[model samples]
Target chain A: MDSSPPYLSILGVFALLSVLAVGGGAAVLPETKALTVTHFHWLADDEFRDIYGLGQLSPGPNMLMVIAIGYWVAGYPGAALAFFGFFLPSSFICFGASRLWNRFEGSQWRLAIQRGMAPIVVGLMAAGTVSVARVAIEGWITAALALAVFGILLARKINPAYLVAVGGVVGYFFLV
Target chain B: MSEAAPAPTAPAAPAGPVPLREIFLTFLLIGATSFGGGVVAYLRNSLVRAKKWLDEDQFLEALEISQTLPGLNATNMSVIVGDRLRGPWGSVAAFLGMTLPGAAMMTALGVMYALHKDHAVVSSVLVGVGAAAVGLLASVTIQVGRKQLEHVLDLSIVAATVLMISVFHISMPIVLLVLGPIAVFIYRPHPKRIHLRRRHHGHDIKPAD
Candidate 1:
């Protein structure tokens, strides 16, 4: 069994995702899940959900879960590649685009583009939510938890981290 | 402690070169301490309120640019604000600062997860967390899309996009390439509309007759 891990492909997948993450990491969740779970078979759907949960528990961008997928596929080197692949291209584009954007300050076309992209970004976010829901929502308890969290967030100003933690405790008692 | 609560009526920050190290440290603090996903609030508090590196208008301007771009808003803001402060290397420092802490922590957690993948308690807790995360994402999407969701054209576009991706399983590139231009064209600047809108904005206010 020759098991050296497919380094180039891991890099390729994440790099593609990086560029396509218009509107942010959440916007590309379905694509990310598709590439990793279906195309590459790098992680199972359940595992993908679990890794995403780990990301939520952490303090920074929840998309840092990509590193876990990389690690699972090709160990530490893969982790490094996924991080670079996922961040660099998009960051580089943003850097250059921002410079150009400043030149067109107050341009009508700029407003047009922002207005147009807004709805599309929302749509993409909706799809991302569905992708997670497919794997994460098992039954009524999970469904109820999701609803409660959604309602609380809409109605109040509490930090979401607290809700996520409370979810874990609830799961500890109920799910297990 | 007092530094944390700098007087609200302090004078404007001096318009001088900020040290690259300070930019890095500021972003580093933001990256490490900003729990949950809303780094925007932490950023506004630090840059606008505490450090006074940018005024409210400047911060919002940076935020608009960040939101419009393709990367994470927190990282994009770091880059734009960092560049505004001290050019390209400033961007590097800020990007590194914004991502490093989370990357390190996530990597550690990844290792821990690998070691204990089959533990029943760990698995159950993760299940709950994932479900809650979905809720978080739903709330965020609603808030962000609230404006778009109200208008018919925007709502239709939003609906169409979800249908293509979630139902048809269309790849992202195809969706962007096809819909992106169409959406842009729909809202493309019309000369008459621009002229009328510009007049309303105090662009060419007339004297009282």
Candidate 2:
């Protein structure tokens, strides 16, 4: 492993990710993959892929990749810094904005802004889905599983956690 | 046009604020147990279903708003819901609630990752988890798409986007730049109908629940 001061690098990467992470953290995935795998050479492509998988399986935000990357780089402290850097700025901005939002609660502009934002958000989220699928869905088995999960979610109304659990069992037997 | 409207019955005073302490603890629990990439579902269960803090419509509206804003949808929604419930302070409370625990857990996992970078058990578990995560992402896409993509235009946008990104390997940022503005322009509400509807309904517009 490249033995630099990884904690600092982790902090810097996460802070940058926080600001540029428009739409959602997933929007930054391709760049993250490139930097970690192709440029920095800190993690191999497969390792980067695995960390992303863990981020997806674990809860909270898929941006949890910061923590995994931090771990790969430095140790617990790197993880701490990565989490703080990734989360704090956005938290502060939203906290401050909430105050301003209340002042204009009744304004027509607020409604219009909300109306305008809805579709854009949906579009960005769709983009995020594409980014993840491109990296993760490699084989016919994986593709079939993805389709099955999608059908179960949209058509069957099954809770998603259960689908993940079932997929884990199947994967252990088949894919793993 | 300038007629004095009857004084609106005092809009129900905004409910007394939820204590910041409760918000913090609630989010902490959410952060800790939010395994398997079900943060939204977890929030829906905890806040909307269990706590009854936000009615379904309110929760849905917040979800919509969070989706539009930049950030994690769950974290953004938590801040919005908290802010609506209390004030700016509530946004902090909700944000910390949702994030701190998960951050701590992941950070610890990072330590383990460094130590056991080549362990067989770790590798095996990751293999299983990674495959499952693929399933989870697929599930989320379907759920969100069904709820949000009502118009044919919206569906078309999603299909085109999926094709461009998945098949053609277009970069995400480029796809976003190209598609984001087009969605906004195409989906802009019909102005004439909005004005007519506003006039017919009078000024006593019901606040979104």
Candidate 3:
């Protein structure tokens, strides 16, 4: 690790990501993959996928995987910067908008904004799914696993954490 | 052009002052305990069902704001609910409590991952984990977009947004700038639609029990 990492760049990237994350962390997956793996070379595609899985396995928001990217790039400071940078701007926006939210409660424009953004957010999320799929799906086994998981999830209300664990076991036995 | 009077009253919560410690601990429990990625349900169970910090209407209202904003639903709800409870400090406490557990876990995982990433066992398991995540994300997207996908215009917009990002590789700002306004304009209010707000409000807010 560099003695003094480029904290500013890390901050700048995550801040931009925070604002652009309109539909949450999943919506920003492609962008995060693009910036971290392709643009910055901070991590490889496999590394990104692994870290994302780690995030999924943990409690709280899965987006917290961002700290891993920062840690790989520049140690503890990088980790802190990534966490604050990713969460702060969006939190402030949520805070301000929420405080002022009721002021426009009954306004048609507010309704319009919500209505208009709904589809767009959905679109963004679909794109995120595709992006992750691009990196994670390698062969028939992986593809089958993904499909099985999707089928199971849509069919039932089981906890996803269990599926994720089962996946690791399957991988340990078969993929290896 | 304005219609109903906009009340500037503070958020409609119970009159009793909530301690910041309680705010932090409540969110802390949710953060530490909620697994499988959907924090919204856990939030509703706690805030509305368990604690009654917010009534059903207030909870739904907060959820709408959280979804429409540019952040994770978990964190945004925490901030909005916390602010409603105890101002900025409450927001701080809630945000911290909601994130601390996950952050610590991710940090420890990161260190372990860094050390053993290249090991065949770790890599193989992660491969499966990542693949499973794709399914998880797809399920979430489909569920969230099920309503939007039914409408023709919304479907088109969804298609366009997906195309722009996945195929065209357009950045997010450009995607939002191009699609956001167009979609909003498409849904712009008609002047002749009087009392539409009331209809929308009823449709959105569930009856308070």
| Top-DockQ structure, candidate number | 3
TM-score for chain B considered on its own, for each of the candidates? 0.85, 0.73, 0.85
lDDT of each residue in B1-209, candidate 2, tens digit only: 24266544333233466789988888888887876564677887788766668876677656655654556766887788888877778887888878776666666666666678577666545555555565566555555455444567666776766666556766556666787666655644565635632342222211222
**What DockQ, between 0 and 1, does each candidate earn?**
0.75, 0.40, 0.79
lDDT of 2 at B15: 44
**Residue A7 in candidate 3 has what lDDT?**
91
TM-score of each: 0.92, 0.75, 0.92
lDDT of 2: 0.63
Say which prediction, candidate 2 or candidate 3, comes out ahead on TM-score.
3
Off by over 4 Å in 3: A1-4, B1-15, B191-209
Instruction: Give a tens-digit lDDT track for model 3, residues B1-209.
Output: 35266635444455478899989999999999988787877887888877678877788888889878888999999999999899999999999999999999999999999899899999899999989999999998888787444469889999999999999999888999999999989878977643543455524432223
Sorted on DockQ, best first, the list reads 3, 1, 2
RMSD of candidates 1 onward, in order: 5.2, 7.9, 6.5
Q: What are the per-residue Cα lDDT tens digits for candidate 1 across B112-200?
A: 89999889999999999988988999998897786444468888899889999999999989999989999889878987656543443
Model 1 misplaced stretches (Cα beyond 4 Å): B1-15, B191-209
Candidate 2, residue A101: how far the Cα is off, in Å: 3.1
**Each prediction's Cα lDDT score?**
0.85, 0.63, 0.87
